[model samples]
Target: MRLRRRTFLQGTAAATAAGLYAPAVLAQAKFKVAGIHASPVENAWNSRLHGAMQEAAAEGKIDYVFSEGVSGTDYGRAMRDYCEQGVDLVVGEAYAVESEAREIAGQYPDVGFLMGSSSGPAGENFGTFGTWNHEAAYLAGMLAAPMSQSGVFGAVGAIPIPEVNMLINGFRAGVTRVRPDAKHLIGFIGTFFDPPKAREAGLAQIDAGADILFGERIGTADAAKERGIKAIGSLIDYTPRYPETVFANAMWYFSPLLMAAVADKQAGTPTGRDYTPYCLMKEGGNDIEFAPDMVPEDAIGPMEEVRAAIKAGTFEVPVDMSEPT
Candidate 1:
């Protein structure tokens, strides 16, 4: 979903128009939540967070507010500002500013800090979660493997961080399961949101004989659109935007994780825990989306069966965190 960027809420009137702050529910007002996005809300990662917050706000669960396009250096300032605003829970990424974020959380013991992090929870308020969408990524690979005529696929990612590494590794494993001899080309553009660089990497891989590209970043689909090749999207479905190019997507829903944190805050319990499990396929945190007409008939049955097996707890997608070469 494309979300319009929301500038940070300013002053005491930080609540949305119909937020819990209104006297209408002062007697049973819900917790106040604030999101501090390191990237644009429209980005794959931030969109999930923003969407969940939007959904919660629509349901009148809490008074929700957020700020997008917050740079890494400014992350701490954002966190402090939200905490000082009397927000009960704060959501954002702590990958680049872990120490500063941790210190801030320590300062505010009452606020719940649910951050997208590679590390574990710190203190009593800071909780962490990784983008655990590998199960769906594996499913994506199972369907995508058969489409590569060159027996070589390309993966364009932001960086080889643990979460990114694990997802790509799962996809690669699924590709191998389908085509034992299938090879892959991997590229990292160093930054998370540079679409042009991702596209360039995808184009380079296409030139190197890759028939299908896994767009772990935004612009890979653009290369596929230009080359008229197949692609798989990461985090969110790009099929609507790149209908002809993106056949499948590894989708992530941040609601399960956020609501759990919210529950803790309401219950007066610490939210400091690893929230990775909430993103598992069984928890409705992650799943796969594929266009039936685009999937090969032969690949469809197996993919569906695998998906069922995963949700049934019979099949487990192995998590491999090693960086791909």
Candidate 2:
């Protein structure tokens, strides 16, 4: 239930030791798979993608390769490299370089490409998927709303894109769910990897009366801990690092769905569909977890109640992001 720091070398070593780095299997496998990312391998979001790949490769003789630290000018080259490598399935999150990826995908007809982007599947062999993380963020906001002493919650985000906007909007909705008059102080750091900027934004929000903070990227929790405010983590749990300050976290499980798609592709299914997979309460894709060290025992019941409502279709979390008049 907490974020564990891992180095890219460590992850690569583990994968290699587990037979994932086998070049023979990769070269002659019935289906070769590759993952590319704009974020570094050490990042929590990218780590989850790595974890998913490791899990999916467990049952089959699939060849697995990865490209990371890819962005802007380098994205096309990376995509082309995978295509030229004769990889059967290529998966990645193209945040800033979506257009570049689309262009590259257009050039590779035999290769199946899946990207986590705000854009469409576009090309014949390309597909797109994004996290329906707003639902989980809203739940985290609801939990933070009552816990805040200042009656103001803060959200530190990356890039202000639709992906990030939904999360911020969801947090705001959750806060309003519990405290109708709650005020949110939001900040955008423009880049996903800049933990220092995220930390600064969090600090600014804390200084502006925000007693509960939402950390969309890596460093916001450090700022929250320093300021003695409760922090809600995104994408992964961070309670292990900031046990006292982190109240809860929202987790996105991307592997199961990706593997399911891989199975479909292996079975000769068509690859042109725009598959937007979601992790709702029923699907077990998204989660709101409380820090064992911080959250009170009595709060679990209400949280489960809300979760059940979401699962049973009784409670719907609104995801619209239009500003209020």
Candidate 3:
């Protein structure tokens, strides 16, 4: 759902009615939000954050300003700059400069720091969130299993981090769900934005008889398109660019996380907590999208069943952080 100001405020009011916060908290609806992104706006991860903030700003929930392409060495300075500028909420990913970012956040108790970190939040004012899309990746894997023509699948990831590893492992498990005999060919491009390197790695997988590819990075879809094979998307939907070659996608929606952070800040409770619940499947954080013409007709029914099971809490997709071989 599009998180307009009205809907967000309504949700906040409903939460207050449920006693999550006092009724007076609704007065703090508007916030001055600033983002310090480590990557460019075109990068999928950063794009999600920037896009959601833009939507919130359009709705008048926040007066948003952001800085992109921030280097790891300068992340703390950028964050401090925002705090010094009297920004109420500072949002960004601190995966590379986790300790430094958290330390800077400690300096500003009045500012709400919602950062993307591999660990939990720090200090009284620092909070954290992540994509947490492993379950959705597993769902994508279930779709990929029966779609594989060569009985071999490949995944091209940006790195071997826990977040990346969980997606790959989840996809592998999903593939095993339907095609237990399926073989996985995995490769990491070492960086998030290198399409050429990702393409090279994906092409090598295709050469090894892998017909279905997981484009965890941006450029793996190019390899799949070149091979005329179906591919899976990550973080955001890529079907518009590769409508025929891309079948299923694991999408990480940022609106829910951002909206939750706003509500917490309004209620004066946004601090020292991990906001990952907003990124879970149950909270509309992560999801899978299937193209009707691309996915096998028979596979769609079971995939829906798995999706429903996930939301209903009948099934749990385990998170595996070990590097995929």
Q: Give the clashing pairs for model 3.
A: none
lDDT of 2 at 239: 85
How well is each residue in 170-248 modelled by candidate 2, as lDDT tens digits? Answer: 8888889778999888888878778888999899988899888889888999998997778988888788888888888
Candidate ordering by TM-score (highest first): 1, 3, 2
Native-to-model Cα distance after best TM-score fit, residue 43 in candidate 2, in Å: 2.2
For candidate 1, the 10 contiguous residues with the lowest summed lDDT are: 3-12
**lDDT for position 311 in model 3:** 93
lDDT of 1 by residue, 1-325 (tens): 5443454444224666545345335424667888999888998889999999999989988778899999898999999888776788999999889889999999999789999887889988899998899999999999998898899999999989888999999899989999999998999999987999999999999999999999899999999999999999989989999999999999999999999999988888888888889999999999999999998999999999999999999999999999998
Residue 262 shift from truth in candidate 3, angstroms: 1.1
> What's the distance in Å from true for residue 138, model 3?
1.0
Report the backbone clash tally of model 2.
1
Name the candidate, 1 or 2, with the larger TM-score value. Answer: 1
> What lDDT score goes with residue 209 in model 2?
91
lDDT (0 to 1) per candidate: 0.90, 0.77, 0.88
Better of 1 and 3 by lDDT: 1
Q: TM-score for model 3?
A: 0.89
Q: How many residue pairs clash in each candidate?
A: 0, 1, 0
lDDT of 3: 0.88
Model 1 earns a TM-score of 0.91
